[model samples]
Target: MALIDDTRAILGDLIAFPTVSRDSNLELIAYAADRLGAAGARVHIQTDETGHKANLVASLGPETGGGVVLSGHSDVVPVEDQDWSSDPFELREEKGQLFGRGTCDMKGFIAATMAMAPHLGDLDLSRPVHICLTHDEEVGCLGARRLVEEIAGWDEKPSLAIIGEPTEMRIVEGHKGCCEYTTVFTGLEGHGSRPELGVNAVEYAVRYVTRLMELREMLKGRAPAQSRFEPPWSTLQVGRLAGGVAHNVIPGHASVDWELRPVSDADHRFVCEAIAAYARDDLLPAMREISADADIVTHVIGEVSGLEPVDDNEARRIVSALTGANGADVVAFGTEAGLFQKLGMSVVVCGPGSIAQAHKPDEFIEISQLSACLDMLQGLAGKLSTAR
Candidate 1:
């Protein structure tokens, strides 16, 4: 009960910082570092090239190998343009639920971890319990990459990682990988009425989008071998598009931002290669015919690779065992689990709220859900203690 009280206030403080992915999260990171340090964990910070965003890692228990690492992102999605009943940054308790922008999306998990730091320090363990928190997870799992690289250098890597990504406390073993790209098509511009005089970049972009749709259908038909996922297959869609100026001009520029979520690792590269081939052989040459300067440019924005837990992975097994779930399920939404998994640590996704509530206005996590998660976290600490 004390932990819950402490967690609620910590989450409120965290929510107030407004650590949006687009903004620097150093304030939040520093707060976490200070807390963990005071609780007697050796804290380390990993910063991006710009030194703006950061990922913080800390450890309790023994400094040796083979303990659990609890991980979560410190960043929240932007609250701008979202309709909310109250100030999105302020945490509100209403009818046994905590309402805030990142309360469900993830600051809640981070709060739980911080609150547990004291208990973890009190426990005597055979192996170290590491805490890994990162920024830019809502953007693309970028900060986790830096954190993973740091973990790799350690003499003793954690045996498993639990990424608390608001999965309603279910053990999640897999999810689709997401890759986003911005494609720009440049063509010759001329008078709109002089049809043959210039290349219409917008028209060419339409062709590219149509091609993308066809490819999407092709991928949709190839069912993934797993039944855990909802669609059980890969998917693609165009998220944003921009082009042209006025009705009177043949616009020379068009750009479409699109993304693909592949069911597996092999599927991700296959889809990327296919898109590149289509750009090279189909769209580029035709656009070039109108003007030598015509070109199609593809820029990768961010990617969250599909997580594939190793057979009987400790992370997956332990979370499933603790939650009384027989098997782990896959989710359609991406998480930071894949990045942690790539660090030679078996990873599982399990956390407090439903993904359904994430990113929506009036987002909340039930008090019961928070209570359940704390119970599980305490249970996990007990498991680690006994194993030692």
Candidate 2:
């Protein structure tokens, strides 16, 4: 009950930071670092080049290899254009749930982890418990990429990572990768009467989209036998397209925003390479004929790797035993788990709250969820204290 009260207090302070992906999360990082430092943990802050955002990695217990990492992101999506019953940044308790922007999406897990830090520090542990809180995960797992790179260079690296991504405290072993992109097309604008004199940028952009759809279907055929993912294949969608001024005039520029959720590496490679070839060999050459200055360019917004499942998973076994879970599952959403997996760590996603409440108006997490997360962390502490 004391841990629950401390968790609630910490969650309120975390919600007040307003660390949106587009804005700085330095304040939140500082607060977490201070709290963990007070509890006798060795804390390090990894900041981005801009110094506006940072990742927090703290080590408790013995400074040794084969530690367990508790990870979560510090950033939340924007609150603009959404209707809320109360201020999105203010933590509001209603019934048995705590309402706020990051409460469920997930500062809740971070709070629970932080609340038990003192207890973890007091234990006679044989292994370390690492706290990894990151920034800009909503944008593309940007912060975790840097964090894992830092972890890789260390002499004492963790062997397991538990990504707290609001999975109702269930153990999730796999999820799809998210790749976002934007492509721009440029051409010569001329009178609409004679179409041959000018290249139509919109038409060529449409062709690029068509190529994506074709590849989307191709990905379907390449799906592995009895895949667990819903639809059982990688998928693509064009999010936005904007171009042209009027019906009679030829538009000189156009752009399309698109994304892909890849289930595997082969599918990701196939879609990316095919799209590049289509643009280079088919679209650009033809567009340049009408105007030598014509061009097509693609910008990478983000490329988050997918968490693959494996039977030889220490993190999964440990979490399953602690939670007394009989089964594991895969989710459709992306998380920072895959980036940690790239470092050869046994990664598992087990945390409090529900994904359904994330990034919406009046988002909330049940108090029971935080209490459950506290129990898991406590169990983890006991296990680490005994793993000697």
Scored by lDDT, the top model is 2
TM-score per candidate, chains pooled: 0.91, 0.96
lDDT of 1 by residue, 1-388 (tens): 5989999999999989988889999999899999999988989888899999988888999878886889888888877788999998999999999999889889888888899998888888767888888888888889887778777887888888898999999888888888889999898898889958888889988988988888888887787555467787788899988898999899899999999888877777777888789889988888777789999899889988779745768887777777887887877789988877777678899999989999888888887777788888888888878555
What is the TM-score of candidate 1?
A: 0.91
RMSD of each: 2.3, 1.6
Model 1, 363: alpha-carbon shift in Å? 2.2
The 0-to-1 C-alpha lDDT of every candidate, in the order given, reads 0.85, 0.93
| Candidate 2 Cα RMSD (Å) | 1.6
Error of 1 at 178 (Å): 1.7
| Candidate 1 clashing pairs, residues 3+ apart or interchain | none
Ten contiguous residues minimizing lDDT sum, candidate 2: 379-388
